[model samples]
Target chain A: MPTPEAWAESFTEATNGDAEIGAHGKYYSCSYMLDMQERKLIVDMHRGRVENINLDVQPLDAYEFALRAPADTWRGMGEPVPKPMYHGIWAAAFRKNLSMEGDLLVLMQNLRCFTRQIEILRETGVPV
Target chain B: MPANGRFSPVTGRYVTIDLEDPDLGGEYKVFFLENGEGRPLVCQHTAGCHNHQWRGLLEDPDITRSHRVIAYDLPRHGKSDPPNDREWWKEEYRLTADFFTKFVVALCDALELEDPIFMGSSFGGNVALQLAWRYPDRFGAVIPVEAADYSPGFFLDWWQHPHANAAQVCASGTWDLMAPQSPDQERWKTWFYYTQGSEAFRGDLSFYSVDHDLRDKLEEIDGERCPVIMMTGTYDYLTTPEMTAATAARIKGAEFIEMQDIGHFPMSENYPVFKGYLEQALQRIEERIGATVSGQR
Candidate 1:
């Protein structure tokens, strides 16, 4: 995962003085609100095609934004297998518009593992 | 014994850079800084890095005056050669950590060091931590700078994610992600490039995740008579100060220092600051050890 400094640098470089990106907490490197808005514009420009957009965000934390991402882009970034919470969140967000898949169930299992990992981090006082 | 000289024993793969210590009755690798007296501070370079990595420490006359510093190239790096058959690279790939551990032990034994202090940067730092963790009895103190704490999911994530420098890592395989310039560096690069590409090494990459959480283990070290110091740069993307601080807080007496305006490789980027910080840490270790010895006496 990129450090908050790296995320801020990248965000600043991407926006080029147009906007300022700041860290909210340990888990989220860049400002979630700003990232969401920028992602929306990129998605719109790509005609809602997720693959056409470059998220340019921290790869590990991409799951935060994956919920609002197009299905194809979400799948391309490892789908539900790697980050199940993200998949779950995506499913819940698009449940009315999309159908759930069996692989996604497996993703739920992986998400459980992710949660366990997070718990471990918390127990160890890793600040997420 | 010669001062500031080089030694290439045909039997050994590496050409040792010897920093002469007349009082010690032998010449050791350049990785060590010798006080014109006999006392020495030993250091080992991480894979694909060199003695120059610790050049900052050497440049500081105060540090050099007090401690003899020694550093050497690991097999297949620096002056070290690739195994004659090259197949040995594959066999040796899995043993990098073990080899280094043994190397440090042997060096200490050969030097008759009662309890030597160790300082490492990057991969060297990881090796140093592991060595201390496994054999806390052997070291007086340890300082790991930007050492990686790989979890089970780290590599899998790396494989899945499209990295900014994926192509380079994929091509070289060795963890010397830092760019280098020089024939010596190129030689080091080739060593990493080959070993990282080896199949045996690939499987062993999972070893990084084997002990994902070393907080408890480090805490035990803190309780020991020996001291442990964790150092990192504020801007170090690879190993941030926050991570180092967390690691430090876990250990009972582990000291954490964050060098400002520096990144992953502080020894190279902020040499003066790194040297100053290291000297301070060593002074603390010396005082602690002295107090312990005096109390026993």
Candidate 2:
């Protein structure tokens, strides 16, 4: 697995460079956390661009929503071609051990952009 | 005419049917697309979607030559409006298995179609199973794609939440229902269809995830009479292959075919891939029903 710092840098760069997100993510401003058990990442976006990715997640670090899962599950989801159940949050949460917490309306609001970003994890791979 | 400017042979028409139930009974002007002749193959699109999902199947010369494809929009979906005289807006549109089955039977009666083969995906698929159980003699066969005995959890508030953009949420929420390998253009087209029916998606799921439970009633369906040919895509998390296979196993003489590399909205997301499995299912039905695709009324 890649280090947290390295993974954050690559994810930020890749998310910023994504053309699909750029085309449709003008209003996709939100901050969400990915809790992979071993580590957590809080990604902040501003007008479709990556504002920051915080590796050191404090207890009170607020985010609109959080997707929590085991390290292995994250690895499965980050595969270039994920298996049937690990394809998306709905799939993973329904079939696997992925847990979603916090305000879901915000997640649903930016679902299109967030879903595309999850696909980007396929290219970048998971740090855990 | 230019290649892209050419018009399709498929024709869409409206048929109004009066549902006779004292409670839910009302006039419904349903919209449908049809072409070709022979055995009638009536199709139902997934929840929060329209008959256009069957665009490829309706136009395919292979299927249409031997089968008349009739893809219809359910009431409150696509071009079909809600009950003409009822105060539908006053009450929540929670679809029930009873009303859905009656509506389809009434539609067939109005069109004077004889023993049409019914095929549907997702919610439509669930209703197919219900039809098989309730009205075995009404349909020649039921092709329930990407369905299970009891599909719960999808009937959520997000589709029509007051604070959310129901269109984007419903569309993007179903994004993963298609396999990542499906063509982007077709997947986007399916996504586009979902955007148009956000109002009815959740209501339709009332039957899909809640009222359409056939868990204990699977044995009630006489597969030999109705010939249930269930097909489910491997990538569909909502109705996984295992769930569909289990549901099929309970029905005596029912067959379950697992479709590879496709997802829930098979005909919409990737019709070419879906067509291969569809042909196999149709062949199985023909073998079971002891009738050829060219069999006439």
Candidate 3:
């Protein structure tokens, strides 16, 4: 029952806090943060410009990206295909933290990270 | 005896097959053909198409002798009246499915049919699959011809198809022929065409849009009591034989047949060939039902 927004927030928190960034500043990429309910992706750029990277438009799953990426970078690189913006970050963040439904707090953070990645992609015009 | 008296009592006169959902209210006519001594076969017409599509098989002397044929019109098409209500029209595809499911069940209940074989083409084919999936026990056999698996993306893709012809049908309020020439006919055509253009159509399509993969379900159905057969035309622009074959492969014992040199409307395009296929299909149906061509119980 977590709203799409709350799910996004938790997604952002998980990615931002994780410490195991790959050697090339790569981090665990997912179409959606585990916290997000509806298959929305979240990614941590290792402090890279949040406003510059573009997400792919074609939806992809973790398994699919794993198959496409080179062996060494596969785990760290996000999905090969891009996905559409599942939920906007601002709406998700506000609802997750303020709403009575605290269970979705974690998911909202993840959605935040997901939306941020999308925003970055839109700015830079590069596929995520 | 009068020509009217020739009609069988079990066949019943043409009456509206009422749907449970008031939103799907409409009038339909059903003609039941009795084979010497027994109940009849129920043949449902494709939506936006007429019984004439099946004239070839119905008129075939050989096939006619073996099984009874009952052909009826869907709402707002042919002789049937549009449902008085309009809400269902807003969600045409799902409503159509619901209406069809209810209509078939009601027809069986009214006619006191034990278990009847279902024959459908195009949209009728989709209805047959749905009926089989939901009420497997009620059906003895299922024949779905050129039935496209419904999905949200499927409708979008269909709209995008180079030969959709939907827009033409919508604007003209009739399939190229203008066979229904009366004012009432034109009104019915417009209503029917517009329903196909509803957002509900898109939503219904999305609801079933699971990558066009029904192999698991079909396999389960195939293993069940009844037999399922899928037929398609070689030259069908819509619902090609390849698609039908993929659907059939999933069902363990399902039969797949592809008619040669035929198009989307095979029953109309090549009646003789269509009738031949039906003759073979009916033979298989009889074998599965354990009933003779006479249609005894």
Q: What's the C-alpha lDDT at position A2 in model 3?
A: 34
**Model 3: per-residue Cα lDDT over B19-45, one tens digit each:** 557555554544433332333556765
Q: What is the interface RMSD of each candidate, in Å?
A: 17.0, 0.7, 22.9
Q: List the residue pairs that clash in candidate 2.
A: none
Please count the clashing residue pairs in each candidate, in the order shown.
Answer: 11, 0, 36
Native A-B contact fraction in model 2:
0.82
Instruction: Write one digit per residue (lDDT tens) for candidate 2, span B1-297.
Output: 787797898999999999977546799999999987888999999998999999999999998887888999999999999999999889888888989999999988888888799999999899899999999999999999998899999889889998888999999999999998899999999999989999899989988888888888988889988999999999999999999999999998899999988899999999999999999998888787767557453
lDDT of 2 by residue, A10-84 (tens): 898999899999899999999999999998989999999999998899999989899999988999999999888
Candidate 1 clash total?
Answer: 11
Per-candidate DockQ vs. reference: 0.03, 0.87, 0.01
- Range of the 10 consecutive residues with the lowest summed lDDT in candidate 1 chain A: A41-50
lDDT score for residue B161 of model 1: 27
Off by over 4 Å in 1: A1-128, B1-38, B82-86, B90-92, B95-97, B148-216, B291-297
lDDT of candidate 3 at residue B7, scale 0 to 100: 35
Cα RMSD of all models vs. native, in order, equals 14.2, 1.4, 18.0
10 residues in a row with least lDDT, candidate 1 chain B: B17-26
In model 3, what lDDT does residue B184 have?
36
